[model samples]
Every structure is written in C-alpha cells, then in structure tokens.
Target: MLQKNVLDYLDSSAARFPHKLAFADEARSFTFGQLRACARGLGTALADLGPQHNRPVAVLVNHTAANLAAFFGVLEAGHFYVPLDLQMPLPRLRGILETLSPAALVYPAGEETLAQALADLCPVLCAEEGFAHPPQDALLDARRGRVLDIDPVYAIFTSGSTGTPKGIVIAHRSVIDFTEWMADACQFTHQDVMGNQAPFYFDLSVKDIYLTLKCGATTHIIPKKDFLFPTLLMDFLEEKKVTALVWATSAFHLVANSGVLEKKVPSHLRTVILGGEALQAKQLNRWRAALPAVQYTNLYGPTEVTVDCTWYPIQREFADGERIPIGRACANKEVFLLDEHLQPVPPGQPGELCVRGIGLAKGYFGQWDKTRSAFIQDPRNPNYPDLIYRTGDLAVMDEAGLFTFLTRQDGQIKHMGYRIELGEIETVLNSIPSMEEVACLFDPERDRIHCIYTGSQESKDIAKLARASLPRYMVPNLYHKVAVMPHNPNGKIDRPKLKEEWIHGNDHRL
Candidate 1:
C-alpha cells in the first residue's frame, strides 16, 4: 500500500517494537509505545489550542528523545514542524521567527523565559505540559484523515545568498520515498543500532530518524560534547553497541585524524555513511586501515532533495591523493548534468548537477520567486511541465558512469583573467603530508585568493609546494595558518565564517 503519511511508519514500528527503545540520549530514553502516546497527547493539545491545519509550528528544544516526539506530534496535529537551533544568536533567530510567523512556538521545559519573549509573535506551548494533556482520538483521527501524500511534513532553514534564511519545505512523499530507498540500499534491519551525529534542525538527521522508524531500529543521539574529545566519543560509541553511523564528512575526519582509532576502535560499527561535504581520501584511508571490514558509503545531495540523491559504496581502494567518486543516482531519482544552456553535457565534461524525482522538495516557504528560480521546467520537456531542481554544484561523469564532484559553481573564480576552481588548489594543498585541513576563498573586491589551513608546515613551505603543483594564477596569493580550523553546527568547515575572519579581517594579507 502507498503510504501517504510519515506517521504510518512510526505506527507500524510501534506495534512491532512496543517495548523496544526507539530513541535515546544521555539523560532520557523512549520506547516505541511511550513515544506514540506522548505524540498523540501533545497532538491533541495542539489541535485544541489552535484549531488550524496545515500551518507551521516552530519547535525550540535541545537535541534529545523529546525532540523526536515533538516532531511527530506536530505531524499528528495536521501541521508541519520547523526546528530552531538553540545555539543560534537572538538576532538571526528573530529573523527566522519574523519570516515564519508560526501558528505556535513549542519550547522545552525550563525555557519559559525564552518562550515568553516571543509570545507576542504567536502562541507558545510548553512541551511537557502539552504531553500531559489527554488524548483526543476522534479529533486526531479526523486531522490525520485530511493529510495527503503531497502535504508538507517539515521545513528546514538554510543560509540564503541574500543573508536571509530560506526555509525549504519537504513533503511527506519525498521523505517516504527517500527513506524506503535508503533502507533497502543500505540493508537496514531491526537489529541495526544507529549513532546519529547531525542536529535535529539539520536535514541529515532526517535519515537517522525516519530510517529507524521504517526499519524498526534504534538510534542513539550522541552528545555534542562527546565530539570535542575523540577518545570519549569512541567510548560512547563502544558502550552503546552502535552498529551503523550516519555522519557528516567533517565529523568522520575529526575521529580519523585524531589518531585515537590507532589506540582503540569501535568493534561493532558495520556501516559508515558520510555526506554534507566531499570526503577526502586521506582521512578515509585512516579509517580503512583500522576498520577494514566495515562498509563505507558516500552520499551527496542538497537539502532540497530529501537527504541525498546519490550513493557511492566503496568497492576499491583509493590513494591519498585520489578523489572518491560520488557515484550514481539512488532508486527513483533522476540525476543528470546540464550545461549553460540547460542542454545535456557530454561525458567527461563538468556541468551543473540536476535532479528530478519524488525526492525534490516542494520549494522555499513563502518565497515563490526564489523557488521558481531554482525549481524550473525541464527544457527538454517542451510539451509538458516536467520540473527539475538545478543544484549549483559542479561534477563530471566518466565513461563508466561514475560521477565525481568537482566544486560549487560559485567556487569558480576569475583570477588574473583566468577562471580557476578554488577546490583544485585546495586539493593540491591537502595532499601535502604536513597539511591537515585546508580551504581556499577568493576576495572579489581585491581579486586575491586566500588559503586558510591548520597543519605543522610553515606558510612559505606550503606555498612553495602549491606553486609547483598549480598554475601561477591559481596559487593562493595569501596564506593563514591556524592551530584549529573553525566548523559550523552541521560539522562542515564554516566557510562563511572563515571568509569573514580571514578575508575581511584587519590582517588579511600575508
């Protein structure tokens, strides 16, 4: 049967694993049955508070088992959810609130002061209080009956080019399709225990949340503090008996480069899937050397396409200097490349990555112009309205049908009257044995390229090697060495923050 609602996955799993732990954190845990009951009670409270359907409900809470229940409760109330980062600055959070104007704001217990500050914007509800409300089965059943496959399930905010957050609304069908395909492709089963690294607000967490419900598996929300200490993080993984890991590439690099794996390894981890950034071969080689029997897969996509549209299972060994192919499209997704004119690019040529399938998002919330600009009609389909999402990322395909990510479209900069890909320069710098992490940013106003890296080598020595490897114009004109590289909440290198600090700071030039 076709599943029109994501709650169906949870309902079936709860029936099968009523007594089993579905989600856990350091302080609390929730069984499948308990989670369902909490969600139903909260849904009833929300439905009675605001007799509206198909509106946004912003959730501000810590990353815990309760967060998952709140998300399901919003869906149960016939409304989509919007997760707000607790660590976000007040100004930015206010901007998002201004844009969302949600039907209600749901806050965790002990955050009444924070909730009251925004009461003027909309109604506010305490999570614990809502969960204690009596369940209204008839009202919830009627609300659920009105939901369709195309209804929006959740909305995630991503950084926009204009500095305002662009909320990406994903529908039930998109997530349902992606989760079903991922479960089968990755062979997820009830016995698999997953360790999730992404935050609730990030789209990467979607895979961990829904995949567990679809497969009747358990997921452990690893504490954020554990990531700062590599050995402690390994201990947490070992103690939890985690069998699968769905993590960002930067997090994988953190553990591999720490040399802790050489001291101790998580014996039970069988599957490691990485995404949100390109996975370098150097750090991956370290992981392979230790856990040789574990399965490693590379996933690539933007939030606009569920979690990921492509998957590459490692079948061969890679040299430290070689690039890992992003590989082919996943089931039910149509992934291709287009040139400047929207025409198909020939094999071996780099072009913009485009995707069209059941996984494409509904579009940006309340921003129709931006949505129309990105999700547009396929030029090839002149007779019909076939839509495709144009991802600004660039890639190349080999004759054997393997796709290799090159860089972002904006990463291509005109320096010294020559078009240069900053990623190519960073690749050369990363191959240096003394270099640990590296990124290249261009200053359009000054027409200069700056290299920010963390490693043991001196700036001049690294520059000498870069000069020998890249063209004269592509070599970075400025270099900044640091003891530690800055990263964002999603675990990717905070490129924007780096640009603000390194390029726009007082001492920008070498």
Candidate 2:
C-alpha cells in the first residue's frame, strides 16, 4: 500500500533498523539514528519559511556525505533543491542562477567565496561536517510538521539547445513511487554496502541516498580524485564488498576493460544498475565475462520522473542487439507511447514517450506555459488521471511492447534546410572498430554541425569514416580527437566544456 507521504519511508525503515549502519562515503559512516537526526534537524530549521517557501534552493556541492544529507534534509524541509556542482565555471553557474531564481543557496564549508557571491540574493548555508554531525545539537529549533503530498522536492537543469537551461521540477510523490518500485525489485538490505560514483547534482544519487536510509545500509562513496584511476575504483569496489552500485555506463566500462578486473568478481554483489546515458552491449559483455555472478540492470528515466521510471533487468540469455530496449513502466507510474497527434501509437512505431502518476514532476519551474504544454491532460483515462510529461525523445516499441529508444526528437539540426539525425551519425561512427567514443552537436550560430571524437583514429581518416556512414550534411564540418570526452556532473557528454575548449583553445571549464 502507498503511504500517506514519502518521508514516511525513512520513518518505517528507521524503526525497523535504527542502529544499523546507514551511509558511508570514503571517510565517514553514519547509522540510521544519526542520519535521521541530521535530516530532521535541517528540515526543522527551514520549516518556518512559509508557503512561499516552495522555491528552489541552489546547492554548490559534490557527492560527499554532506551533499546526500542536504539532499534529503532540504526535501524533508519542504523546499525543492537545485544542486550545482562546485566544478562548474562561474559564468555558467551565474547563468543557471539568472535562469532559475532559487530562494536560498548552500555551499561546502570552505567555499566562502562562492557563498559570498550568492548571499545577496538568498540566505547561504554552509555545511562543513558530514551528514552525520555538525547539524546535530544545533540551537536552531525546527517547526516540525508534515511533508505535503503535492510539494515539489527538487529541480535538475538540462542543457537546452535554445541557448538557455530548463529546470525540471520533481516532487516528493514521485520520489516515493520510484523508491517503492526500486526497493521491491532490487531487494536491498542493511547487509549491502553500495557505492556512490555519481555527483550529488545528478539523479543517480537519489537511489544511493534513499536505499541506504531505507535499510540502514552502508554506502561507499568515491571521492572526485578517484574517478581518473580505474585500478583504484576496482580496488574500492572489491575492498568494500560492495553488493550494489549506481553509476553511468562509462564508470563500469573503465573497470571492466581495465586489466585489473580480470576474473576476480565480487561474490556478494547481486545487482549492478546503470543509467544517465545509453549502454552498449560490448560494455556489458566485458563486465559479464568478469563478474558473471553479478546480475545486471539498465535503468531509464529523465529528472522529470524522480530517478527512474522503467527498468530492464539484465538476463543471462542476453543476446547482442543493436540497442538495449528501455523496459516497462515502473510499479506506480504509467507509461504511454503517443504519436504526433497525442494519441497512443501502436507497438513498433516511433512516437513520443509520455509519463504520468507519482513519477511525473510538478512541472518545470517558472515556466507555466511550457509546463502545461508538456504536461498534458490525458484523454485516454479519466479515473485517477494525472498530467503526462512529454519526453521529447523519439522511441519505438519492441515486439514485447517495451520501448526501444532511437534518439532525441528535438536534438537535430537543419543544414541546407534538410533535417539530420546527429545521434544516428554518431552511432554509425562509434560502430567502426577504430572508434572509441564520439559526440555530435550542431552549432546553429555557425550554420554547421560539429563533432568531437576520441579514439585511435587519425585526424585525416575521420572524413573517410564519415563518408562511409553519414550523408553529406550529417557529416561534421570539423573533427578533433582528444584524450577523452569530458562529462558534466550528470554523466552526459559535456557540450559546454567542448564548446568552451573550441572557443578558447585551453579552457578547463569542467
């Protein structure tokens, strides 16, 4: 049965196992008792902020234990949090604030400089200690109440091709729906030690935080420094006896293909979840060859739907297919494949993916028109009907009626007035034996689509490879090979970083 609220999940889990270990990053660990106290304290401190209190609170932090603490703490406080990593540039960070006018901001204890910059607009809170301490025994008394059934919980910004950013507003109800669906399927326990490889700003951290607090389980969080070292990551996973993991496709690929992960798999690990981007079969094959005992899963969802809306449990009979199909809708959420006319498209035809139920967000912040336009009232069902979020990604249903993702419907360009699929061309390029990874983006201002590639391909041969697979306009006007493609906190290819480098020649705006 669905509870009256999502925070009650922690209440129930805490009662069941209060003294059990709850969180573990690299340097610290906390029990359920400690974790709850910190969350409630922080929640109490912000409770007095009135009904207008539902505005966005910006956070400049990383994936530390403090970040997770603040994530739940602020959500429980009844305000939506917008996390911005400290690693992003000042100009980009300023642009995000200008677009999404948050109510308050939080920063790491020592980042006084950043906090000072934000203090003029909203109150700035500094968290120096981990989630387990500091906030405890505070003089600030919270006006305790209940988390509203319809309050927005958080907002994540997606890079907009329109020279702006879109902040997706998710609510507490959606978080509960996703947590319930995930807990039932994953079967986590206090015995499991999970790792947090993603940044707190990313949606992947939602699972890492909730599952730990739910079971009083311990989480092994990796620091920013270790992301560059593949061997160190393998050692961390094995040393901590990590039973489950939530990360991007690239993180696991770094370990599976690295010679250190050969033959020795963690025996206790039961589930390995991958999301935030596409997963290739070759990456899965490499991990399966080593960690045969670990059951794998590929999760899919936009920030609009909490963390995940659908999942495909990786099976042993895995066959090599062109693309991995994003599985059925989550337990409490409703999934619909709709045509251009907003009607349900039949199986095996391309259409837009529409989502409803608790998994759907309240809507985009500050953009009521876009919100109402995208979150449509479904004409199909009336009883318990909710607005459906229109996912702009184009998808086709499989024979089993599951969704097979093709590409983003809006992420294309027009050259010579002809429409082009930037992703399709990149997919073809990545298929070549010499290519390792590729990114394709259109520069509308430049009137040209550009590509930045990584691998062993010679600069002279890029045009040849494109000639074999891509049409004339689809082929990039310029190509460059670098050591590796950069990624933002969300694990997607960092196009801002790419554009910055292309413009300034040595900018490290990561």
Candidate 3:
C-alpha cells in the first residue's frame, strides 16, 4: 500500500510557483524549479536500487542545501532516512550504523573522502553526484510512481540510557497533517517567509521544510555560527523580512537576554514558535515586552509523534513567576489524561497523557517490540479502529478541557525514599529572579543532586533563592555556573553532557 510521499507536496508547490525561492542561506538561494529538479534527480537515481536492497537509508550530513535535497529524495525513493548528527563522534556514529545496517550510506560530496579514512563502508552515494546518473528523462517525467500508504518520511535517532540510540519513524501521513495544520494555525500564505534554525537532523527542520513545500511559502536556512550573535541574527531576520520562525526554548531565552538584540527587533516577524521544553512565564513577559504583537507558541511532543503533538498559544498577559501549561492538542490530534488503570481521569487529577490521531508515526525503525508496546488500541474512540501512543508524560485537564503537562513519569525521583518530581525542583529554580535556565540532575554516587544553571546570578543569590521555597534536602548540593546548558540540535537540555562534565567523579557539596 504505497502512500503519497512528502516530496509530492514540494512537487505541487513547484508547479504553482516554479520561480519562487524555496531555500536560501548566506551562500546560495534555490528557486522552486531548481529545488524540485534536484529532488527528482536524486529520487530517480535512488529508484534504481534493487528490491533486495530495500531498507532504511542512513544519512550523515551537515546542515546544508544538499541535506535538504536528500531529505526529500530519500522519501521519494520509497525508503526512510536515518539522520545522524554531523558533529557526533565517529565511534558513536559507528555504533548507531552497526545496529541498523542501513541499505545506503548517504553523505555530502567530500565527506566520503574523510569517511574512507576512518572505516570501510558500503553503498555510499555522494550527495552532489546523487543526480549524476539520472533515470530516463521521459519515464522520470511521466511516472508519478507508487507511493506506499505507510511509507515513512524519515527516521530520527534519539539517545537511550542503555543499548544503541533508537530511531523514531514518522510516516507520510503524519508529516502531511503537520504541514496542513501549520498552514491553518499559523495562517501562512505564499507571502510568508520561514527561517530554518534547527539542523536538518532535528525535528525543528520539519516545520522549515513542510511549511515551505506544502504551503507554497519561501524559506531561508540559517547557519549555526549566527546563533552566537543573537542580535545579528535578528538583524538578518529583519533584512530578510522573515514573517515567522520556530526555536528551542533555550534559544528564545538566550536571544531575549543576548544584550545585543535588546529591542533591536525585527519589524515584519509575526509568529515566534518554541518547543522542546516548558516556557517560563517571566520569559514570556520579556518576549512580549520586546515584540508585543508577536504570537508565542509552546509546541510539545516527543519525536515519536512527528515534530509535535500539542501546542499552547500565549495570547494574554500572565503572572511573572508562573510556568505556562502545555495546553490543548493541535488539530487532527487528541490528547487524553489516563489514570493508573489506563482509564480516563477526571479533570484536575494527574494522569498519564496519551495521544491518538493523524500525527502518530508508523513506529520505531527496527525495534518492533518496543513500538508495539507504545502503540496501543484506543479504548475511548469509536469512529472505526484507532490506536494511541502512550506519551509517558504526567498531565491533567482543567474545567475548560485544557490539558497541562506535569512531568515525565520517568522524571520522578525517589529521594530519601520520598518521590519527588523534577518539575517541582525546576519550578523552584525558575522562581529565583536571576536564574535563567535550570536543570536539576541527581548524583547517586555522591548521594546528592547537582543544580546546573546559566543566567544572571551570583552564587550567594542562587543559594538564597534555593532556600526560599525548598527544604534543605531539596536544595542542590553543588551549584555550577556556565555560559549555557548543553543543548542538542533540537534545543533541549543535553543531560548526558551535564552528567559527564559536572556530575562524574564529583564529591563536592555546597
């Protein structure tokens, strides 16, 4: 059962606006015609793959126009792509690939030269030359090809505490739903220009790719170094007249306080979307002060459900010291709170939040058992057969049917034999006036918890802030200040680095 591929959206967009710019960075800009032709060529080249070789293809490429082409090309070829971070250590990457034994190894033109220097690999396609051996032009032009009903769009690799990293497999339907929802929710027209912030590997790029391809909008790709100069980044947005953008919560905070970008605001920017973490009310206030008319959205979801499952639009004024809730589900998705028995929980009682609908992914790439466990039959829905993914997140709904995220069930800590939610500790940390970003990690070896931070505060001020609402044991034993918290490409906290750098072999106390 072949389904419509993600690139079909781009193909349709190209037909309507062949000359409109589809992708751009400081180095180059691609019109819809050029981008579509490149994707078609890559697809045609990859279509020559034999039946015995049909398996997931893994791609390790940097954030570039080439990666963007591969993103669509892999889907059009009827194979899922495993996106690996370009900056990851070679050993870590080797471990990931050894697990999947992917069919094709896709990389940039010059990367295979470096790859050969490290390990002998197979079936490698130079991205620049991917379209070199194009298919018969007439057949390629005439054949729309059969797109499988359940063919995956892409496979995103995520870390696990044990074993190799896992791949979250998203299907074409989920990608299409997200794009259509975005087109409506954001009110994007062909006039809108979107900026690509997150790397092609991370889910944030989904918003960048689909919005442009499906909605007939223009897109601009941002480089990594520009982020260091938050003010200059804003200037770029202004000069380009970007209408909308999405960013990680950590990034939004950095830009708001970046000092260089203080009210050096862009005039045409409208929607400022954020995700991968909870939004602090005080941070929202700062953003509102700077761009009052801009719509700020808190997008929430794991990689299993495409880019996001739910979103909260911050519309009005809020209290300074509060944390905004995760809010309701987006269109085409339904979120419900379930109790210990997996039955629906009444409003206001905390329960595990579950998701069901069009945004759900096909499954994890190779771990069928794990995928089966997460995807379950929906007990509540009666409109034909339905399956829901247990989100493993604790949440509750208010009288208004608006759901709010509490914390991950895994985030619970049995401290001194008392179960404590990390969200509670993080909220206390946010209450501190000077604290910007806070992450509390438990150190069992030292029998203490370490609170890591980056923001405006002295040690004494932070200590004073900690003692105000927390019991003595709840306070972090060690306080370390750094320039910023380690964040993955998705803009979420990198707790692995936190453990490695600050927690390992440390026996110090405050």
Per-prediction RMSD in angstroms? 1.3, 4.5, 2.8
Question: Better model by TM-score, 1 or 3?
Answer: 1
lDDT of each: 0.90, 0.71, 0.76
lDDT of 2 by residue, 274-362 (tens): 98777666567767877788879888888877877778887755432246777888787877788878888888777888887777877
**Candidate 3's residue-wise lDDT over 1-510, tens digit each?**
333667677878889999998888777677887887776677667666554323677787687776777766666566677788768888878777777777677787768665564345447776667755564555443333544546667788877544357788787788887888978987888899987788777787788888888878888877777788876788888888999888777777777656654558888999988887777776777778888988888888887888888888887777765668788888988888888778999998889989988788887767888789889888776677788999888887899987777788877677776767777788778767677788888876656677888887976688877888788767777788888678766687887778777777444533
Clashing pairs in 2: 44-142
lDDT of 2 at 109: 69
By summed lDDT, which 10 consecutive residues of candidate 3 come out lowest? 140-149
Clash statistics: count for each candidate: 0, 1, 7
TM-score rank, highest first? 1, 3, 2
Candidate 1 lDDT tens digits, 395-448: 999998889998999998999999888887777788787778999999988899
> What range of 10 consecutive residues in model 1 has the weakest lDDT sum?
501-510
TM-score of 3: 0.92
